[model samples]
Target: MQDFLFYFLSALTLISGLMVPVSKNPVNGAMYMILCLIGTAGLFALLGSYFMAALQVLVYAGAIMVLFIFIIMLINAPAETKRKRDIPSLIAAAIAFLMLTVGFVMMAMSPELNQPMPALEDAETLAAEGAIPFDGSAKSYGFGLYGKYMLPIQVMGFLLLAAMVGVIHLSKDLHARSQAMLKVKENASE
Candidate 1:
């Protein structure tokens, strides 16, 4: 079951990731990116890192992706025209491919790359260690987050709040300037 879920989510993530860049519509691309992020979060959950999974969902999928979508909407970018691939772009892509191949070869030759995985503790042993028993309740997760990781969480919240305020200020400034220009035009007409 775990293997199935891992493969399923992994495939979904990869497909969505590819779709994000390949989709012609900016809105569709953004939506695909959000799906990719969510799929990655699901994969994280399958790996037993509940905290990471929640953080992925909360920060990347929930907040950052929404901001990206808003920015896309605000800019109202027109659909990109299909362009011919020039020789320089092809050469750059070839160089990138060669570099990746070299990196893969180096990694494969390294002994550390083939290191055996550590044995994981069973649920019974984890319970003995006083790890919070996973009762599937949100309260336990919330307690762990706010109690153990409160400082980092608060910092993230403040950063997000600052970003939100900045966006609002930029949008309002543009709107006010446009309104002022309209008023000036009206006065000039009068």
Candidate 2:
């Protein structure tokens, strides 16, 4: 049952991931990416890694995907162009199809991939031995992030701040250029 669930989730993740890259519309791509993240989280849950599953949902699906959707809406990407099926694109598609088929065959041949996991024995013993340390919960994650990963967390904050400032600067520059073009047109009309 778990093996079947794992394969199903894996297929879902792969299909969604491919859609994310192949979809021409940015909004649709972002939605597909969210689905991919959720499918990945389901796979993690099936593996008994609940902490990873939660992080996958919260961090990737919640935060990152939302940010991507916001950015896509802000930019308002142009409508996709309808191009004739070119030879190069056709060749690329064929290659991708072949690769996917090979991957599926490889997975089917691997019997270990379908095996079930061993049962958990002692929760406290696992924690003390650091096998599954820190309760594997959200609260423990926050504590570890603030305690051991404080410096990295602060660094990520600064990085995000820098990126925000950079985007603001770029937008301002574009606005100034557009205004100057309008002034030039007005002067020419005089």
Candidate 3:
């Protein structure tokens, strides 16, 4: 049963992940991302890390995706002006790569990553309970979120708020530019 589930989730994740790139519409691509995230969460659940799975759905598929869609809508961004798209994508990709490197380092340092297999007594208790223990779940995540990571999370929220303000400012500038262009065209037509 577990094998079947794992394979099913693997296929779902792969297919949806593929769709994310192939979907031409940014909105549709974002929707596909949600599907992919859900599949990933299923895989996490099958691995017995249900809290991570829930977080995957809640944090990623829910909040982050909504933010993405909101930005996409608010920007209604102009037809891919090369300078606009290229520069931002390059900057974002570089930042993502750097962040990924930092993430791998943090993962390597995690005590859980070095943990040995569970003891026989603990395994027996889990079996008797017929449920994987919540040892890997919300308590630890909440602690880490509120403890060591609180400052960074708050900083990120501020950064996002700033970015939103920048986007609104850009939208106003773009609108003003278009209106100015229209005026110029009308004056020339006179």
lDDT of each: 0.83, 0.85, 0.83
User: What tens digits encode model 1's per-residue C-alpha lDDT throughout 1-190?
Assistant: 9779989999999899989866889899989998999999998787666777888999999998898999899999778777775789778978996999899989987998876434345544556564665533467778877987899999999998999899888767787889999999999999
Highest TM-score: which candidate?
2
By TM-score, rank the candidates, best first.
Answer: 2, 1, 3
Per-candidate TM-scores read 0.63, 0.65, 0.53
After superposing candidate 3, which stretches have Cα over 4 Å from the reference? 23-31, 64-134, 175-190
Query: Where's the lowest-lDDT run of ten residues in candidate 2?
Result: 126-135
State in Å the error of residue 44, model 1.
0.8
* TM-score preference between candidates 1 and 2, better one: 2
Candidate 1 least-lDDT 10 residues: 116-125
Question: Which window of 10 residues has the lowest lDDT sum in candidate 3?
Answer: 127-136
- Give lDDT: candidate 2, residue 151: 100
Model 2, range 1-190, lDDT digits (tens) per residue? 9779989999999999999868889899999999999999998888666899988999999998999999989888687778675889879988998999999989977998776544555455545553435355677777878987899999999999999999888867787899999999999999
The local lDDT score (0 to 100) that residue 188 gets in candidate 1 is 100
Model 3, residue 35: displacement in angstroms?
2.0
Task: Name model 1 segments beyond 4 Å from true.
Answer: 97-148, 174-190
> Model 2, residue 172: displacement in angstroms?
2.4
Model 3 gets an lDDT of: 0.83
Off by over 4 Å in 2: 89-135, 173-190
